[model samples]
Structure formats: C-alpha cells, structure tokens
Target: MTRKIFKQFFLALVALLSVTFALTTLATADTSNLAAENVDITFGTTVDADLPAGSLLKLNQPAGAIYPLHNSTGKLLSRGIAGDASTAPSLTTDQIKLDVQSGNVYYQVLPDCWLQSDSTVTLLDSTGQAPTDPVALTLKFVDANGKEIQDAKTFDAQFSTTTDATTLATLETELLAIRPAVTGYNLVSADQAEHVITYHYAKPTISTGSTTVATQPSDPVTTTTPIPAKTEPVAVKGTAIYATKKIGLYTSPNFSKATRKIWYQKKQRQNRPQFVVIGYAKSRSGQLRYKIRDINHHSLTNNRRGYITANATYVTSLYYHQNPKKIQVISGHGLNAYQAVTLHGRKLHHYRKGATLEVKAVKTHGLTTRLVLSNGHYITANKTMVIKR
Candidate 1:
C-alpha cells in the first residue's frame, strides 16, 4: 500500500508543475508581445526609416521575391513573402532626417495635440539617459517610384526638455500686452509655412483736463448829441438905380426957382446933360409920346419960354439944382454974355447978342445958348461963349 500511494503523489506533483509552467509561458509570451523591438530598414544611406513599437508598417517586394520585417518576439510587422509583379510588396521610403546640416529641429503640435516645446526641440531622455522607448516620428520624402511616403506608427515616446514654463508665461503676457498680436499665433505654423488670418477687437481712449485764459469785456454803446439849427438873417428893402447920365439929388421941384442948379456951358456942350432919361410920356393928345429928358434947348429969345425941341421933354423930374454953378451950353462957349430975365418970379429968357429982346418980338429960329444964372434964371444967349464953373 505504501508503494502505491507514493506513485500517485508523484504523478499529482508532476501535473501541478506542468500546469504552472504552461501558465508562466503564456504570461511571458503576452509580456514579450507587448514590448515590440525596433526595426531598422535602410533602402540606402540616403533612404532612412524609423519604426516604433505597437505599429504596423508596409513593405513592397521586388517581383517574385519575398521579405518580411518582424519584432524580436517574432511578430510580423509587415507580411507577404512574394507578390505578383503587377502588385509587388512595398516598403515605405518616407523618413525625416533630424539635424541634417544644423543641430536644431523644430516642430509644432497640431491642433488637438499636446505640445512638448516652445520654439525649439532637443533630443534628451527623462532620466538623463539615452532614449529607451521608441518614439513616434514622421518623415517627408519622395520614394524611388515617386510615391509620397509617411510612417505608420502610434506611440507616446516623443519628448523634449527645451520647453520652459517661465518662457511660456512670459510669452503669454507679452502677447496679451500686444494690441493685436495674439491673433497671429493662429496665422503661422511651426515651419512658418501655413497661415491663418483672424480679426481682433480693441477700444479707444481720450484725455480730459482744464485750462485758464484771459478775457476782456466789450465797449459800452455810444449816443449822438444833437446840434441846434441856425437862422438866416433878414434882408432890408432898398432901391438900386441904373442911370445913363450924371444924375443929381434935388430938394425941390420946378427948376426955375430951384435952390440949386446945374448947367452945361462952354466945353461941356458936347456931353449929355445930367439925369437924362429916355422914356415914353403922355402928351396933350393923351397918346404915347417917345421922349428924351435933359435935351439941348435953342435960345430964340431972352426968355425961358421957347419952343421945346420935338420929342425932347419927358414928364419925370429933372434934378438940376444940386450943382448950381455947373453950366451947360450948346454954342458960343462963354457964360458972361447971357442975360437972366424974370417974368413974375419965373425965369423966362433967351440968348441976346446986341438985338432988342421982347417977348412978342422974339424970333423963333436962331443960333442960341443956355446960361444957368446964380439968381436961378436959365436964359438963352446969342453970340456969347459961356464959361464953366
């Protein structure tokens, strides 16, 4: 009985050990599949490819040839042993060379992605060691077949140590201070190849203050003073005479017994008598008679009663007494040869030169002269030369 129990216990221990080993193998297999190995594919030194873990890449084979890319755990990254010439297996020639000629590389996080840098990118590890995890990367190039190439990978291994929190904060503050600069971030890409235009809003400002000034008032209104009007002086009434001869001022009428007398004698016979007036008068027949005053009288007798020259007497007053000694005569130029005779206190005389002088015997036609006497007698004289006083 002891021998039989020992055999059964042995078998049971063996079975338990076998089951634990299988389970361990299965877990190890799963863990190994989770960590895929990196694959290096080189078309040429100029042609480069980068493959990350947990990704699928495609490769195209030459006609009638087959190739495969696999991880360290024997999982196929690309499949197809050999393909038809018309549809050969293809490998992506797309790759990007970082720090090709220069030592700096730049990239921008696309929209909906997280950024790892500000303006620069640097290759470094989190623990200050070489990079251990595979990085998801993309390259831009044209293949030998002129086909556009890109990496087919998904990973979270891309990192950069150049991102500065202080710089980002400072940039954000400066951008906010810029009136319209924040909108430009949407306009340019990391490569500065893309642009997005947008509008910005702003506000206006103004200043207000006070000032002092000097001013003056206006002048008062003026009033005009009125002036008194002047009156014209009154004119007095008087007489103005326009005379043609030497007129006299007399004190009486009737020249025979006048207080003063004026006579034309000697050389005065050629001049017109004083107060000579040419006008019309009323005759005895009551008709208009044209008359001349201060005319030369003829001496036909020793009396003043002699025939008046036709149309020679005017009825207006003759002023002959103002200058008594002023004589006037028509001929025989002397005053002493004439006589003065009075007829009842009226002078009536004529010129006489050795002839009998009588009122009834006076001749009507003869050479005569007029002599003005100091006794107020105007007599006619014959053959006598009158003197002027």
Candidate 2:
C-alpha cells in the first residue's frame, strides 16, 4: 500500500497518507497471454472498531464503475503459481472481460485498496488552532482534470449515535479527502479508491500451422496517471516594518492575500503569533508584500524545501488589508484618508469629494476608511462609488 494523499480535511475515521510507493520494490508476476484472469475488487475496513457490523458504503451518484476491496475473511493477496507468494485479487467476470481489451492482457493480481477505520480529522490552522468555523469541510474524489466525480455517498442507515447504523457510508469507492478552503490548491486524481495499481502486460505466442513466433507485448492504451504528488505545507518568514516592533505583512502585495503570523516575540518569549511583516517584496500598483515564516517546520525529504508565494502568505498592514480591489467614485463631501490611521494626520491625496477613482484595497481604522487609488495614491473610501478600475 502506497502513501495516499490527504488534503487537510478533518476525518477522524481515516487518515490519507500521500506516501510515494516505490515501483521498483515489487517483483513482476509471470505473464501468460492466453489465459490471464482479472481479480475482483471490493471495499471494507480491517479495523475492528465500533462500526455497525453490516453497514455498506456506496456513492451518492454513479460516476464510474468503482468496487472497494473487501475486508471480511482477510486481505486477498495477489494470485500466482507455486513458489509465487502473491495472492490473487477477487474481481467480477465483467471487469476481467474489460481488462482483456483489443490491445492488452489483464493480470490476476490487483493493487491493494485496504481502508482503515481508526483515524479522526481535525482542521488546524497554520498555528495549529481550529478556525472559528470548521475549516476543512469538503471531502471527495476527483478526476485528473480537477473535476469532482460525485456527491458524498450515503449508507442505508442515517449514522448518528441512535441511528440504525453507526458506521460511515462513503461513495465512489474513492479514498481521498478534500478541503476547498485553501486557495490555489486542488486535489486531482483519476485513481480509484486512492490505491496504486499495477498491470502486467503479456504478448501471446501465435502457433500457426507450421510456425512458432513471438510477438511484442500489447500496448497499454487505457492507462492513466492515477496519483498526484504530495504537497507539503510551507513555512515563510517576514521582516517587521516600523522599528516600533510590529506591522502588518502579507504573502503578496495583493490585498486578497492572507496575513502571515509572527511566530515569536523576543521580548515576551511566548508562542503568541502576532500578525506582522518582516520586510517587503517587489511591489506592483503601489502594493507590496511582507515576507513571513512558518513558526514550526515539517522535516522533508527528496531534497524538498518550503516557500511562501505572493499568493500564499503575507503581511497585513493598513495598506494590505485582506480584501479584494474595487473601483469607485469619491461620492461624499468632507471625505478623506489619514496617514496615521486616525482622523488627525495629513491626507495622502487631495482628490475632490465625488471624484471617480479606483480603490485597490480597503482597511478601516477607528472612523477612517483608507483606500488605495489606481494612480498609486491613497484616500478615504467613504466617498467612493466604484466606477470599475
């Protein structure tokens, strides 16, 4: 069983491990082109937990022909001849027929698709704290094209402590959990039940009336890239602005980017993460990003390293509020922005009230509504009637 990828979804019943399985480790089974058999696949958990004794798993809708591995008697091993330790997988006759297509021969051994039922999920912030609302909410299987396959499957029973069944009902025979909260990340795989599959190709020897000749192995016409590479969370460090101690920082100059955390405070020596920036990155439209770092870093292999992108983490200053941009006209009178965030500092611009302008991002300080103008200027958003920047 290879490591399955688990998108930061909260699931206490099963853990998705995106473990990269080494293909070189498995010894190839002998191939017989004339009589290759297909192993049937089914699904069930080996864990002897408190699940209902006979609850079944099914998909919300039929997207593809998916069968989970069974867990009744024991794990069905790959099939082979004597001295061949591989156990044969159980498959329906229909799948076996499909396996023997016009250009390929199927094998009797199927990949492992065992489902364990002991893990639970908890959505954690980068700081290891749960969000005010549940963060990791959606979980499902997807095709390699990044489209969801089906709705969450259900069981015959409504699972509550008092419901007829206490076991989980899953759909698609797929084994991947997804969290859509994270931006710019997607879970894409055509893999079935999240199992790594291997196929044995066999070329038959045609015995003509008076000739004996060998043919090349059949081409794999229907094979597909079934698994996505693991994506580890990254740690970023940012420099603080304003020598006074801390200022807002962001992953990028984009106002919509998230604010990075200040992991440590030298003066306090506590784990309190303050939203602050360390330094600035390149700016565009007068918007700049603050460099930031992850407080705790995960150890990685494959010569892996972590990075914060213009889209991932950032500093949150008054100039870099976490809001999307909007263009509007300064519509009211006596409206303006203050440099000190209070109603007391000099204005960054002298735009007349009711003037049309583009508001890049917004931040509210006390009674002031600061706005970043399209011409690289600042003003209060109070009078703006977005005219589309």
Clash count, one per candidate:
42, 56
TM-score of each: 0.13, 0.18
- Tens digit of lDDT per residue, candidate 1, span 38-118? 111121111111212222112222333333323323334432223223431121111111110011122111111111212
Residue 100 C-alpha lDDT in model 1: 8
lDDT of prediction 1:
0.25
Residue 28, candidate 1: how far off, in angstroms? 99
What are the RMSD figures for all models against the true structure? 73.5, 25.7
Q: What is the lDDT of candidate 2?
A: 0.28
Q: Per-model C-alpha lDDT, please?
A: 0.25, 0.28
Best by lDDT: 2
Model 2 lDDT tens row, 1-389: 32353332322112111111211112232111112111111112111112222222211212221223222233433322111012111111111111111112122222322221111112122232322421111234333344444333322111232331112212111122111111122223323322221121223356888997555444422221122224522112221111112333332334342533221222221112332222223344533233333322331111111112332332222223334466444344435555554545676655454455555566565323556555555554431222344
How far in Å is the alpha carbon of 294 misplaced in model 2? Answer: 34
